[model samples]
Target chain A: MRRTSPISVYLSLLTALLCQLFPWVGQGVILRPDFMLVVILYWLLRSPNLCNVGTAWFAGLLVDLATGSLLGQHALTFSVTAFVALTYQRRLVLFNTWQLLAYVFALLMIERVLILLLKLFEGNENPGFMYFWPVITGLLLWQIMILLFGSLTRPKTN
Target chain B: MLKGVHQKLEPQQSPAFFVRGPSPFSRMVFFCALSVSIMAADARFNYLSQVRQGFIAALHPLEVLANAPSEWTRDTKKYFSEHNRLVQENYALKEQAFEQQIKLQRFNTIEAENTHLRTLLNGNIPIQPKAILGEISHMGRDPFTHTVVVNRGSQHNIKAGQAVVDSKGVIGQVTRVYPFTSEVTLITDKELSIPIQIERNQLRAIAFGEGNNTLDIPYLPTNVDIKVGDKLVTSGIDGVYPSGLAVAIVTKIQQNPESPFAKIVSTPVADVSNHLQLLLLALPDYKEDELSKVAPIETTATKKELSNKNTALIKNKAKANAPH
Candidate 1:
């Protein structure tokens, strides 16, 4: 297993926050990925000991402050998503690349649905199916994360 | 031999592979409760606005850094624009300004005449609101809320509840003020409503945002004298918006035989997507006094006291202005 430093983990999360702050205009706003969520999930899966549910909760709080939504909305959803990811974390070592990708995809979808329910509960209008566009973009970001910082699975030996 | 065997069979503690501090379930429950309480406090009370303002102020530097790349690109594009296009725009703007100046002269005469007539009739003269120019920093991050962030903020003397407008017409209102930036809730947001009058017939009504980029005027009877092309302008009774600013144009009206109220929807005239510069009009100075008077009649003595104070101030102003 590759060793991950705490500094690198935090630096990457800060970069993700910056990306979230980018001024997306027109259709770009609709398609922008959940950057901080994807990065937090990546670290949570690869090094659960270093980054935990508390980290995810804090990151979600920052997102809430940045987005100027009702406070704690993202925090609630993010902590729940982190818990779900950690529940099956031990079994992940035996999974292959494809299985890992599917797992991450499911995690992303769960987060999206939770946020949708929260928004609906807050009396917002249904944003339609285009709201799910971020899940696809977040999946692509996951692949990029794997490419940059090695995969979660161990290497094969003959 | 039995003693040796027993010693060897003693259990040993081994280091675990995963060293997570807390169980995931417990952590989830803890954070969930924390966040739910936060949401409740934020939604039901006014305690968190100060926290939000301080956080945004601290995050201002990072936001500017994130916006730098886009600003650079726009500047480069502006530098590389064709000179011919600039000249043409300048010429068109100059001609427009000349036409507006002529209209302004006529307006000045009419305004003076109206003020003279109001004074003769002992009516209160309307106040002209001051406005500050602001640029749209970005569309709001939350897609669920129809809002835009403006560059001006509390540091620039921007206050919440100020009306916003563009060159074309009314745009939105300032709902939250940070240190260097403010959030403007667009008129189409479901939470905002504006008092409006039909420009063609002078019939007054309140228009609410439908959350789908349309304004709804509910409770207007089906027999009301409104048309598809009727214009809606600010009524100015609320004191937030100036009177006669264009707001929206009636687009679609649906009526059912069983229902008495008409389903009226209109599209806003000022589109935030089309422009980046807008004006934030200052809140009226007497708004506080007006609100105090409108407060529920808790005590008859206090209500009478407030009315007396208001009349005294008005009389003092009238005496000061009486052609001395």
Candidate 2:
């Protein structure tokens, strides 16, 4: 695996933040992936030493500010999801590609469910089933990340 | 010698395996607590509005950059429009303006008559609210709430709580103001409510947003005077929205026998999706100091009335006590 630096990780995360900031008009917003979450998950799984739960929390806070939702709604979810991902970090190397995909899918679902619960608590109307579309889009982005950055599974090296 | 030095450096550096600080559980607990407190402070105390505004101001440049592509596309589309279409549009606008000007001439006389009549009755002068034209910069980031960001903000002296209206009717009210942008919470949002009156009867009631593109009027008797297709307009009792502004049209009135209150649903007249430009009406200035100074007699009258009520209450209490 190629060595990664903290700066590159931050740069990629910022680029993802920019994408999130893009003015998604009309129904297109429903399909827009949770860019920051996907990027933070990538770095958290790949380099947990450099990117941790705190980093995910901060990114989530930025998203909260941007989305103008209650201040810490996304932050709490991101931190919890990061913690779950970190718990499985040690076993990730042994997992096959399908298993890795399944794990990421679960993390994305956890984030969505957390947000839905928070929204309900805030008295927002149920946004309906389309709210989960981001998870599918996020999973696609995760696959692209794996394809571009190489698999998280250790290669069979002689 | 170089290889020996590199090997020595590698051994001195902490390996990635040992570099993970503070277990994930602890970090999660700490961040979770921090975020919960932030949410509490934001929701209960409103201590974080300034922080949000400062962050949004700092993020303004990034916002502009993000909006640049769409702006360019809109500008290009405007540029490539055919001249024939432009000329036809201009001709239609000129004819419309001429008709409006003729109507405005008659309105001037009616307004003067209204002021004269109010002066005769010693009624308070009607405030002519000033408005600033603003364009919708973007729909709100969260879809669950019906809100839009306008180009005008605190920099333009747009204060929170000002009523916003489009050409058709009332759109919403300004809920939050930043440096260069403000959030207008639409009347269709669940958190927003507007006082409205039926145009035909002038029966006043408050309309609450139903959170699904409809306004609900609850607590009214099932046999209330409201009917489907009744026009609802601002009552201006709360001094927030100006009186008589078109708000919504009553669409459906459901009288369920199981419930005591009638369920009247109305969709807002403002087409938030059809237009981008809106008017942010300036808040009415009813200066408390001026009213106190000018209406001293009125204040004394109210005070005397209150004192009389207090004495009557005390007399009743003493009568009951004496009997005991």
Q: What is the DockQ of each candidate?
A: 0.90, 0.76
Please list all clashing residue pairs in model 1, or write none if there are none: none
**Weakest ten-residue segment in model 2 chain B by summed lDDT:** B291-300
lDDT of 2 by residue, B1-324 (tens): 999989888868677767677889999999999999999988776778889999999989989988889999989999999999999999999999999999999999999999999999999889899999999988888878888999998899887777899998999888888899999989988888888999999999989888888999889999999889999999987666889999999999998999999999999999988878999998777522232233211222333454476689889999989955
For all candidates in order, the CA lDDT equals: 0.89, 0.88
Docking class of 1: high
Error of 2 at A138 (Å): 0.7
Considering the two chains of model 2, state its CAPRI-style docking category. medium
Top candidate when judged by lDDT against the true structure: 1
Task: Write candidate 1's Cα lDDT for B27-81 as tens digits.
Answer: 9999999999999888776568888899999999999999999999988999999
Top model number, DockQ: 1
Model 1 chain A worst lDDT run, 10 consecutive residues: A148-157
What candidate 1 gets wrong by more than 4 Å, as runs, is: B1-17, B288-324
